[model samples]
Target: MNLKTKLFGEVYQFGSVKEVLAKANEEKSGDKLAGIAAENALERIAAKEVLSQLTIADLRNNPVVDYDEDEVTRVIQDAVNEKIYNEVKNWTIADLREYIIGLDTGDLELKRISRGLTSEVIAGVTKLMSTLDLVHTAKKLEITATCNTTIGKKGTLATRLQPNHTTDDIEGIELSLYEGLSYGMGDAVLGLNPVDDSIDSVSRIYTLFDEVKNKWEIPTQTCVLAHVTTVMECIKRGVPVDLVFQSIAGSQKGNEAFGFNDKIIEEAYELALKEGTAFGPNVMYFETGQGSELSSDAHHGADQLVMEARCYGYAKKYNPYLVNTVVGFIGPEYLYNSKQVIRAGLEDHFMGKLTGISMGVDICHTNHMKTDANDLEILATLLGAAEVNYVIGVPGGDDIMLNYQTPSYQDDATLRSLFNRHPIKEFEEWMEKMGLIENGKYTERFGDASIFFGK
Candidate 1:
């Protein structure tokens, strides 16, 4: 059978299948709607297998021997109360994959958020992932590797490093870091950030690249660098490079909220297109603790408004490879009503020209009281429900290196007693009663308790 037939067969959405295929075939020169619809149909079809593995009945049924139906009903209701909770709890990984595929094609936009840091941040990431076991648990997830480098004044690292540090020095660092990480975790996507604000900086970057061209492997890697005046210099010098666009927010208390000058953004977009570099602008960026409110004077919430306008304008003018938006610095509002915050951001990007958005969940400060694992889980659920792409904050060195240590974990006998309640025990006994065993055992996979209980 053909790809479409197989996908449709999996999803059991055969009726609209022909209509979808017909629409896909009837392509106009620049008709985006048709393309989006076709992509959506394909994703839904692809996700069928994973979705089949889940059932509301399985989740709703209590495993405890003496479980009270009333309590089980309440828990189920609570879980289903939120839109995201409702949509995701029953979704299989394949369903998620379909959603991701649709997101890639712009049928749906997935917003991914990640905290930013200098090269020193990697150590924090290592510690954080170790604590969470995030990578080992995630299956078939795409990991992207990225490195940020800067232009040094005169005799800085960018300019001074020679044969020992090739142009690929930055790339090499990123690869090495990723390799170390994946050895303990899984594979990831690799991207580079070479900051070129001046001719000298660009020259240094190119020189670095020249040293590593061909010697470096990893064909699937993607590059993200800036398109400054130095970009032209690199091109003239015939340096193999990929460009990435970034928006820098101005200082919080400074004269103005900083961002890419409009003309510069446009120029970079045009240049990257001309040179066939895989480039896209980083839309959402803000300083630590700076919330959603766009800065005034120089940086303002209006920046988001302007970014939306510019992205759509560019999409109309030129068919770029990808358009991305980022929603950075999730505030208390995100914690309180993460669903709403994510929904609004996704709506803005979906209504605009963005192909996808990155949702940032930065935890720069080391106040354990302020951020915790539960907070991270809430954010993860919200992102999953929003059906957007997002990045989790891998603890940075500054966060990990802090002298302050969180309080020691305490056992809660009260909580344990609550679980010992007859209803809870009955539920467990019932699961035992049902003989519903996976590999002849019942297991709990989520929550801290499950980790402790071996269930």
Candidate 2:
């Protein structure tokens, strides 16, 4: 495969697919920190030029991590359909880019071609795409998944109710959840990232979620975003878990840093199927971000975007009900500022959909980052326009437990209104039943958690 190009009479060469992918990426602090980023703007453009000419087969032949050494590589490679691969093996990354955004390529054609591509190829084309290119191409793919209810039905925008508490206080958590539900949120799943991961603490929270779901007959799913093993033990002890949650990385070593493996993940999924509450083949919910593999020292010299795409490929193996990137939560060391964060958010959402998973985003930023609520709003609007499956909804856009900021319950409510979208059909019907929404607009009763107090 050719990896040489000239920009303004200067020669630029990349040693491998890994180098080309890294250099072609738009500026990211993590890649710079890794000492792999292109030296200057001209070199970056040169890398993109060379990357666009590389064929799919070039990427397929050069897995970032060897298949023998990495289970993630093995899973992604083993899953490729040889017949589909052959049809597109000769296509350059540039051709794939135009074809994806071409007028003729809709969801059906994208889905069919997606069966042949690997995570590396996905990352390759992503490097050549503009910010708006990412958004427009993602608009054509409407991926969905089901657990208790379906998400991504074209007119629906769902949310994961993150009623987090710094102390894991039951009353505080319940109060936040009640407030969120009052705002017509939590249709995707009522999930909490608990301060405590002990089985008793998790069990108590799960019991509370179960009691509330039954008492109100709310048509939604519930989960406690604790460690996979903690939730596994909870399931064995009969805690009602609607979804099994895990924060996965693109590589096996990064997953090891998270203290689990494919074996552990597979076992957890099997246990959820046999003993958990959700009725579905899609039983897993995974959260990923750009810098995770690099943070864990498991990036294998690949850039964050390539590693991020590998996440979706790895996630597709289990047919997860939910797969979201907590985009800006990794901080400025990876994404830097608002411009970088927004770009990563769009790229992640598009790559996830292209990988054929139910894609959502936690359009978030840490305190130290050069971003604020306005940047979050901009990205959320773009994601809403792209018809994302869901986004994380926390009280006031601040995650007290995780100490980060994401979309608020009220922000998501406004997003639905702005986009002319509704929650999952069953949850919207439940909202109507509770008098929170009327004729697709909020009623006077909305935003009042007290309605649930007397009941």
lDDT per prediction? 0.28, 0.92
Best by lDDT: 2
Which parts of model 2 have CA positions greater than 4 angstroms off? Answer: none
Question: Model 1, which residues run further than 4 Å from truth?
Answer: 1-176, 180-189, 192-216, 224-233, 248-262, 276-293, 296-370, 385-455
For residue 224, give model 1's deviation from the true position in Å.
5.0
Per-model tally of clashing residue pairs: 46, 0
Top-TM-score structure, candidate number:
2
- 220-274 in candidate 2: lDDT tens per residue? 8889999999999999998899899999999999999999999999999999989
- Among all windows of 10 consecutive residues in model 1, the one with the lowest summed lDDT is 152-161
- Give the Cα-based TM-score of candidate 1 against the true structure: 0.36
Scored by lDDT, model 2 comes in at 0.92
